[model samples]
Target: MLKMELFGESLKQIGCFQFSGVPCSYLAPMINYAINTNSFIMSNNEGDAVAIASGISLANYKKSFGVVLMQNSGLSNALSPLTSLNYTFEIPILGFVSLRGERDDMGNNTDEPQHELLGIITDKLLRTCDIAYDFLDSDFNEAEQQLQVAYDYLAKGKSYFFIVKNNTFEKCALNHDKNIFFEKKINTLQVKDSNSNFLPKRIEVLQHLSYFSKMNEIALFATTGKTGRELYEVEDLDNQLYMVGSMGCVSSLALGVTLQTSKKVIAIDGDSALLMRLGALSTNAYYASLHNKGNFCHILLDNESHDSTGGQFNLSPNVNFAEVAYFCGYEKVFIISSFEELEQALCFFKNRNTGGAILIYVKILKGSKEKLGRPKVTPKQVASRMANFLSKD
Candidate 1:
């Protein structure tokens, strides 16, 4: 209850009545409170939340602010916008991340292996981005003051963050509009060309992406999944952007980078990750309508399983992703089930209008790479490199 009161007071004090970001069990109490108060904007991913906040700040113009909440691991997904777009373009964002493995944090035994590094590096990652942040462990007044400091930074064209340990906040009144929380629909589209039934192996898709990489006009970003690992192994590690953590957000990050630079951006993502955060497609459509960045291409590789997590099955119903893209507002949507068709789609996307985004769906087989290597560089390094790359003429 003390934590809830402190969080409420902090939100009111900093003028951050609006909140966004994907849900995490670690921050359930805070998320529940935000929803209860009708101040939460529940976005598709951390990156989408940051982009939305950026848009809100740009449109409102009177020091508008929003809160992005996520697990520490999701920080990798949100770093692109945090560094390249927000830092470079001077868009202020405030993040409230839930720390998963504090000395007294709950659910430590049940946590995933991937979250271990995130638990240790959260603070270091923030500092690397040049963001001034504070850890809210138990002191209510200290948390409030930190929020104020964060607000000040946001007002001055910089991002601020406050990391709270898990379960620090107690349950409060559920005062949010229930209508705002809606279940996302699964979108699966059948390929129009059934004759081209030859799907490419992961190696083949990687080779084709390599061709795109050679062009110098395109930059590739991979999400956290088999697709990302395969791309990492097959592509030049130094030349491409690989998200070691932060599932379901490569597309949004690429969109932010594309918005900032003229170079075409490609995101290699997976079906499970896409299912985890489908709301990003709608956000992409919305942003495309406003900014019209023609250089963003989202390549969704559908394997129908969480291959990185013990090949768990995703029971998403067959829905049309291309139609979903169209509904979300992308002018160019191509769904291909075969390698040849994918190649054709890629060629078509390359020549399409530079005003809207393009989505190309590539269906692939699901399996783990036995000896896939992890990323050597930290998330901050990847972010800084992306910022530097996008800033160059």
Candidate 2:
């Protein structure tokens, strides 16, 4: 088997230093190597890992690469962002998916029964997602060549994956010791039930947030759906990335951007989108504290309905988002329903300097202005410009 250093060093030579993913036994060696030598964000799930990698790739301006590692079963968890976020945005990431039930020379399946079906369909699934992949070579020199080929594809803004079999890399010990502890504080501002309907509309909140972004010179990631479309209508700036299809990934992607840049990064999220991946809140909070990213702001526009999909009622009303954020490890949490509270919250965020991410849960009504329009700027252009914006000193 090739030493893990050979693979890791080769990836470094090819400009890939950022890595994230869920744990897999076959991938443990490479994961250990990355943990010891590079920046690896152990994501809460595979999809978030892909989206975080996308954020790193986008912010790096193609000068560096992000790698994703997961088991074949977890590939299903990664499929959404891999297709919707990476493919749609042309964000390239090097993915290594472990082959759990690979066939041997005699063509017999050689893995656990649990992996049978997924193993049978893994390659087909990759093809269906339009991801080109190669079997990781057992030879060190050949694998180094494979890394260069992967870089070639990544340079073209196309993701290249590697299907890794068992024992592909020599065992490597995790030498890094990491410790992160943050107090969970729940701070809430009570709003009267009578004032619920009178709360700010989604567009008004966007207008305020858009203004705050412009005034602070921050990068904003608007979640998929009306939040992004509305932000596009509010103001389409080079520093704003309007997520088109990767629902529930805005915060995790913002976390990636926060790790890559010192600029304040704000993510505008929706109730439905946040619910799609509730685990992201915990992931974002954890990394924010671990990395000491005080500039990350997670704003959830809770309307209790999916306004973009005909205003269907959702479960947001039953849940206390501020408490969730608090328990999830956000250093600061604010619940605001009116413009006055929002303004105060923004001022506090701007003035504050040291803490983890700040979560602003804004309760709003579920309605948009008549004839709301989508962004005229293409997703690739958005990604490119945001990369350039982040690259600036």
Candidate 3:
């Protein structure tokens, strides 16, 4: 049994007495402690936990901290809010992640195949999200210090996490307010009024890219949501990086691979997700400048809406993506509105070596893939395969 008194005291010291997220058997001790002594809220899912935390932070105008307790498998489900809301709005959260079956000293492996991936790739997921976190141990004093550091990061508008292994904390009382109140406020206003026919087609751009490049030579990283689904439906997505979750991060992931691998890494990112983490472009540019790797190409499909979520307007202004790329230190930036222009841009990007990132902005129509199926591989599996692939000659 794990004791939460130390962790609770640390939370109290940081003034982050509020908690959120779903329950996990591994987190029962901490959950029970929180319910017994702190203000905690239980959400429907991990994503909802993040959303509610975001709301609380925005409403209170204080550094709000929420402990999202969920099984490692629920990480994918929580990524949308993690990458989008947290990354975009710079909402800080302290995730109390329960690592259920990660002990090496265990006699028999009770973990499922799904959990294996989660356990292996949890750090990678946090890294891609640009979140810094630490693993929790039984040492109450050390855990308290770590929690304090997490609180400080949260104060600075960055998400931090504390990964807890199974049975790490001692059992405690459950005395939380049953009614964890959250206001239900919805924004129903449409930001854009024009039903413009000027937007281009996603299929046209995909077709052009497929035609221009040899499929084997070009590795595509598709962002989560409609852009990924569309690419999966259009191309032979055998080993292509089809992001299951973690929206607004395909470009960053592409940059990571482009830095290490010799293959051309192309990221098919959506406008909404791109806008969510626009700072990623600057980060990518900084790294590209440092490493001088110029094989990264980010194809931004600007549909001006969150097409995956019922076509809600993302308020993405009609800004020149080329200009944005140039400002971010991209060596070559191309804003294409037609198939021919995209083809020419691709050719130029393939040959350019100015030691920077490239942004190819394609104006696309907003549409959802009604029949797009989920990818077979998990994020952990993909990470493993990619690591192995990079390690090879």
Clashes of each: 7, 0, 10
User: How would you encode candidate 2's per-residue C-alpha lDDT over 245-279 as one tens digit per residue?
Assistant: 77889998988888888888899999999998899
Where is model 3 poorest over a 10-residue stretch in terms of lDDT?
184-193
> Distance from true position, residue 93, model 3, in Å?
18
**TM match of model 1 to true structure:** 0.58
The regions of model 2 sitting more than 4 angstroms off are 176-198
Candidate with maximal lDDT: 2
Give the higher-TM-score candidate: 1 or 2. 2
Per-residue C-alpha lDDT of model 3 across residues 192-231, encoded as one tens digit per residue = 2245344667766666665454443566667787666666
List runs of model 3 lying over 4 Å from the truth.
1-199, 210-216, 376-381, 388-393
Candidate that beats the other on lDDT, 1 or 2, i.e. the better one: 2
The predicted structure with the larger TM-score, 2 or 3, is: 2
Locate the minimum summed-lDDT window of 10 residues in model 2.
185-194
- Overlapping backbone residue pairs in candidate 3 total 10
Judged by whole-model lDDT over C-alpha atoms, candidate 2 comes out at: 0.85
Better of 1 and 3 by TM-score: 1
Model 1's alpha-carbon lDDT is 0.67
